[model samples]
Target: MNQIKKWISENIVVLFFCMLCIAAYTIAGQNPYVVASDLINRVMRNSIMVLALIIPILTGMGLNFGIVVGAMSAQAALIFVTHWRLTGVAGIAAALVMCTAVSVLCGYLLGRLFNRTRGQEMITGMIAGYFGQGIYLLIFLVLLGTVIPFWDDQLSISTGIGVKDTLNLQEGMKGALDAAYKLPLSTVCIIGFAIFTVYTGYRLWKAGDEEQKAGRRGRIVRWAGLGILLAALLVIPVTSAVIRRCSIPVITLIFILLVSLLCQFVMNTKLGQDFRSVGNDIHIAESAGINVNRIRIIATIFSTVLASWGQFAFLQNMGTFSTYTAQQNVGTFSIAALLVGGASIDRANVKQAFIGVVLFQLLFLLAPAAGTKIFNDSQVGEYFRTIISNGVIAVALVLHAMHKAQENAKAAAEAEV
Candidate 1:
């Protein structure tokens, strides 16, 4: 009972959204294949950006809205690569290298800005995003052809004064990553299961006798569940058909997997523990000889770099770049998705990031259909999406404030005792 209540309290947002998804799915009446395909595509596009927010949250910096700057860095790289006529894998490799360079510089400077702002990191990040956008506009809009001396017939304006508002990436740059490789979804699932089974077995093998005994029941239940899932994946014809119909973007999915694993791996390292310490209480962490500001800066740098890579993946998958507008909402949507996954302002993880992306994207996919079904207009769904993305953030902030207040009051009472 107590445990159940605690679980409910922690996961209330996730549960609420899950219920909403079910309701929307029922109303939408969409085919499973279409939904699954769209959801997978969206997951591949947005998961890395969502994951980018984790390090900052762990190190006590809020959502790092400055990720827009990183996205901008990627766009700049993409533009240069396209201009250079680099094609296929080589183009992607060049763009990534360029993106990383820019992201590192931007991240380092942004981290310094964050260190100065301290408690106001979130708002500072938002301002930094706007500030960076201004600089981006100045360079791309004003200086590109005038001061920078760059001109391409396809990429530039009619007068060659600036880049075009929309840049077509048909020059072997589009789908460069996503189209590189593909794998059957069923095979992906089998591989996933195999990896998990090995990991579980390794954990059991490494456990002490007492620890193993204590967790035997839980381990048995988990193994049973995995066995059933694997069996269904192999034996159930309907499940097998659905899985077979889906094709995973092998290269893109591999990047997402690497990022997910990196996030988990980082959290277990000594630096990651320092991040947690700083997040929990900076004063205490400082007293313990931790460099709180340095930790925060490192966290910001990691987030910004990841966001750059994420935006690179996003544009490659989409096959076009909107130039000025593509990066504007990167931070907002990513933050909202994280919040919807049951992460608080100060706490987040890889699992929450994955769960958030799936749920958030599902709702996004369903909203228009459900709206059309009930209201005879798809626009209502767009409005609902806007509300959901912003509203979730507002609600989470309020809840976090309330939680903090309660904690403070409890501490006060203990002090009195």
Candidate 2:
């Protein structure tokens, strides 16, 4: 085959998978179309979390494995909000604030750590994630009672070392966020993410102009997007009714969108360009007068804030927090999801993260059923899903290293040649 045809043939696997999925959905159920809606919702819910990785990826710092640190901040904020009896959008707002504060601090620290350990950012980030988890656990489990004030017994452990096995947030607010009685307006925010994706694509199409131009200014887009986001934030309740309503998750999503867009806008500014440049090539950026270390610090902080927002969304959706294990493994899995979405080691877009979350989650949600169809045993499916999710991360990391190796080899060979 010619090169063009060969390229198409090489991508045949994706086409085949798409066709296979359609076929299986049609064959497996009486309501394949109904199933499609659930799939879409799952995609919408998970995509923005994936969207959070874009900045770090743009800066060539690799996946924000330190996003776990941000996730910890979010979970901590969530716990406090719940303990304080904050409900509805107010609770979510407060949680975001708390999460952002924690994320900024965590990001600042992580940036310093990364700066000290430069080339091993991924490993430094991974270790930072663990370090944050320990700190997070201490706050949630041990410190909340003795040092911090905890009024609720449910939130406080019997031994007072940590929270209980599971802290049901609704016992305080009673499904204030997830109540089906509310409107499903949050769906609009999900739609907003889609709209943002479309806008990003449009921007990509206009990249040549953008690159050559001074700056986007982005005033009209900014004001208009903010106005729409605020409207959706207000309508989250009314919109929740159209679908099975979940207010908190929707609120969390809108918050995340606003934050991510804010981050995107930041990336597009002069400072933002400098930030990207530093990530692209630190030596060049530094020579050009960019403060590479500061940019790295700022980038880490940005990643933390977004990840914290993501964790807030995740928790608000579940309306329950697993005290011990909930926040620990976030970075490993989330970074994996981004990788699965076709993001490379040094670059990721918001859309890729969204696609990865949806695709990864579709498999997560359906693998048991899909497995039952194939293996007639869902337990087997469950086990396999665990393996697949972890395997995706492991493979991505390995692929990242291999790709880096190839780049170094090619550069060296070219120099020699």
Candidate 3:
């Protein structure tokens, strides 16, 4: 009982997420398969954006509210793709190349500005987003068909001097990735679970070894037991569900998993180590002869470039883009999703990102139906999710601030002692 209590305490946030999901499922009473299918799709679509946040966080830039700039860059490139009538993978590739170039420039400028105001990166990023939005508006709303040479009647406004408010990609590039080969959920789940079990066991064993080196006895057994329990908890029910013969977009799933794996791999490289050191203490890193500013710039550049590709993926999957407003909340919801997954301003990982996508999309999937059931209005659900998403971000920021305050106070007390 005490062990269960301790586990609950350690995982209170995840527990709350589970409880909310249960409440949503009960109140909404939606089709289980439908929910699962939607959850899978949304997870693949949004995970990249959320994962993009990890690098900036690792470089000590906080939540990187400036990712919106990268989203904007992608949106701009998307306009050209739509205008050129580029279709399928070709369209996505063009937007990626264009967006990467734009994001690199934006990230470099933003990084240099952030260096000028070291501790204020988040605020600086937020301001830069707003500032960049203004420029974005000028380019698309005014310059696109006017100063720039765009000639697509379908994409441009009737007045022929700007892009339209919304661009549809159904005929051009929708489902390009999702239309690839399908896979049985059971096979994928088994493979996934096997990987999870081995990885979890290895992590626990390493932790146990570290504890032993520090003179903590019996930790190995405890860690092994805990890891086994966690692995079972994740695998058993999920495997059972998979055996029901559901299907997934196998190619898209593989791509997402590859991206996740790439993120983990990057963390083992020299650049990743520099990101960690700078993240932990920029002053200390500088004293160790690291190029602190250069590392930070690289981090932002990677984050921006990743966000661009993520946005491109999102646009292709959704089949439409609201030119004026599509990217506005990219940073907001991605950050909220990351925080929902158990990431913080200072630390995040791919597993947390995927988990966060699942949990966040679960709420997104059920909130409307639940709202309609209780209030007799489906629109309530839409409003609820919007408010809740922003609310989660606000709550996370406050918690981070409070945690920092507590740490500072503890350090001061220890110094006095």
Candidate maximizing lDDT: 1
- Model 2, 191-255: lDDT tens digits are 65667667755765575765534334463467468768666655676433434433234543455
Ten contiguous residues minimizing lDDT sum, candidate 3: 211-220
Name the runs in model 1 displaced over 4 angstroms. Answer: 233-239, 398-417
Q: Judged by lDDT against the true structure, how good is candidate 1?
A: 0.88
| Least accurate 10 contiguous residues by lDDT in model 1 | 395-404
**Model 1 reaches what TM-score against the true structure?**
0.94
- Candidate 2 lDDT at 56 equals 76
Count backbone overlaps in model 2.
Answer: 11
- Candidate 3 residue 159 Cα shift, in angstroms, is 1.5
lDDT of 3 at 335: 88
lDDT of each: 0.88, 0.68, 0.81
Please provide TM-scores, in order, for all candidate models, with all chains considered together. Answer: 0.94, 0.75, 0.85
Which runs in model 3 stand beyond 4 Å of their true positions? 1-10, 170-172, 194-245, 398-417
Among all windows of ten consecutive residues in candidate 2, which has the lowest summed lDDT?
Answer: 9-18
What's the C-alpha lDDT at position 131 in model 3?
A: 95
